[model samples]
Target: MATLLLTGASGLVGSRLLPRLVEAGHTCRALVRSEVALPDGTTGVRGDLADPDALRQAVEGVEAVVHLAALFRTTDEDAVWRANLDGTRNLITAVQTYAPRARFFMASTGNVYDAAAAQPGRETDTCSPTAAYPASKLAAEALLADSGLTWSVVRLPFVYGEGDGHLASMPGLVDRFGLHPAHTYSVAHHRDVATVVGMALAGTFDGRVVNLTDDAPVTVYEMAAFAGQPIDGSSEPLVNPWAGRMDSTVLRGFGFRPAVPTMQAAARDGIL
Candidate 1:
């Protein structure tokens, strides 16, 4: 069992991950911005990502760091940069000084890839971030590369399940973002996401940039059907062109299998 320093313990993925870490025999020390109780048996320390002293305190005697903290929906570009980029520098500095030998795992997004590509995005594919959220995440990945630490990054897909409202909001999101009915997107269940993190902590894939996604991509029409809402197909030009697909072969090559393989499976199993 290893001692791990974790950030974003209060968020969706983090809330799910903390308990699994404990059950796996790993001790987790969570970094929180407020005085919130962590999953039972784990410890919490109040801190912002940019506070070096706070990071230092939270990182003591840990074998690894799992960074799931990031700004995804804060529309302000500068706020996105500050949280996703500048805050990363603060964590890096603290890790260099206090936990240099610990393995670093960053939660990244598939959005870091070019959305216009013809094929599913792979780790070796070129990155062309189209928005502030992805751009900032990519920048943080660069910072981790230069931090001289042992690291691995997992680029996550559109995550859902465990009562997360992402799937339920698809119809509204498609309308709000001008998405097409035929658009296809890769997805992963929150259970599999937690499993992937547990595997990362076990050192299954280190010094690697792996994409974690399901085996298939779902079209927007299917998404609408799943949500019990029908949509008129292609009212606007398809803006996201990558087929919204990610190749998860590398992750499977590392001995990982998704528990909930598709949204259909999630809905049938009452997880959606």
Candidate 2:
């Protein structure tokens, strides 16, 4: 079994990803900011992503690295830049010094794509990054591109499911607003996000950037109804709109597709 170093192993995606990695017969060395409950047979290392010394210790002896640590807000430009860009720089430096041959899989966001007033964004599309979160992620991707290691970047859309604070709070927006808002949206389950990371780690694909998204685009109304709280009205425009589509052809070509489709399924399964 390959020894894997996983940063952000205690966050939403990382928490779910740990179990899956273990179940797949790989040993995971997880880096967390503090002590937390973890599954048996897994090793937890305390480290700050911003600290190169701590990062080096965390990656020691690991055969592969799955980087899931990053600030996930569209706001807070400074925090996003430091956490995503500087943190990635630290990790890359450590890997180069100690684990240059290890495979590196960086988790990025689909928001890196240019904010188009359309659907189904392909992997080759130009990046716009309207918000701090996407902008920082794109910067991190650029850092990895020149790192000279065997690496792949997985650009994921909004991932919802258990432990997803942003998505769980989405239902409240519907109650306050209404269905058929002005903007459209796209979503994927956390399990799928973890799966995509695993696929990249397994070296099953050659593409540098892979988009991870669901089968279809989902609107705010559809998501609200799935949460068992329908929007108040249909006339209210969807406010604060963002890009709601991604082309997952590159990911699917590697046999990775979201098993979960509808928001209702995600809610029912305790994933949303």
Candidate 3:
């Protein structure tokens, strides 16, 4: 099993990923900012991306780096960029310094694409990410391209599972992102995200961008249901005509399938 360094090991996705990696026969060295219990056979290294010496300590002898750390939805957009972009630069530099041969895997977002595109985003489409959230991730993706590491980036859709409760905040998302009533979005379960990360680390997919999503686009009405609210005429027209739809053909080529296929199905089964 590979000894891998996992950043953001305590966040929503990170909390789920650590156990998934452990179950897959991998030993994880997770980076954290405070005292926390390490998973069985997993080590916790106290560090921050701003501290170079700490970064080196965290990655020492790790065969792979799954960099899941990110900053999101802050009031300050600049802080978002620095955390996502500068933090990534710091991590890659440390990897180059010590674990130079280690493979790199990043968790990115499909929101990085232009929402009003002509078609559902594919690996070949260009990115014109609008917000600081996705823009920072795009900058991080660029850093990986220059890092000289074998890297794989999986662009995830709206992730919900394991009591994520992200669906409960749709009112804020609607207002913040200017979401529209007819607007559609894609989604995936947390387990599917962990599965994709595992597959990427195992070299199942690399050297290209892959959008990991479910089989269909979900409507704002469905989101309203998940939020436990009624859909009113408060929404506007979608800015990105193709915002929520994505192409996952390459992901299928890796033999990865989503366990929860849609919000409705997830709700019926109590995953949403």
TM-score winner: 1
Task: Please state the error at residue 34 of candidate 1 in Å.
Answer: 1.6
Supply candidate 2's per-residue lDDT for 88.
Answer: 92
RMSD of each: 1.7, 2.8, 1.9
Better of 1 and 2 by TM-score: 1
How would you encode candidate 2's per-residue C-alpha lDDT over 236-265 as one tens digit per residue? 544445556788887788887677876667
- After superposition of all CA atoms, the RMSD between model 2 and the true structure is 2.8
What is the TM-score (0 to 1) of candidate 2?
Answer: 0.88
Clashes per candidate (backbone, < 3 Å)? 1, 6, 3
lDDT of 1 by residue, 85-191 (tens): 99888898888889899988999998888877878899898887869999999999989988899888899988888776777788998879877888889999898
TM-score of each prediction:
0.94, 0.88, 0.93
User: If ranked by lDDT, best first, what sequence of candidates would result?
Assistant: 1, 3, 2
Question: What residue pairs are clashing in model 1?
Answer: 115-242
lDDT of each: 0.86, 0.78, 0.85
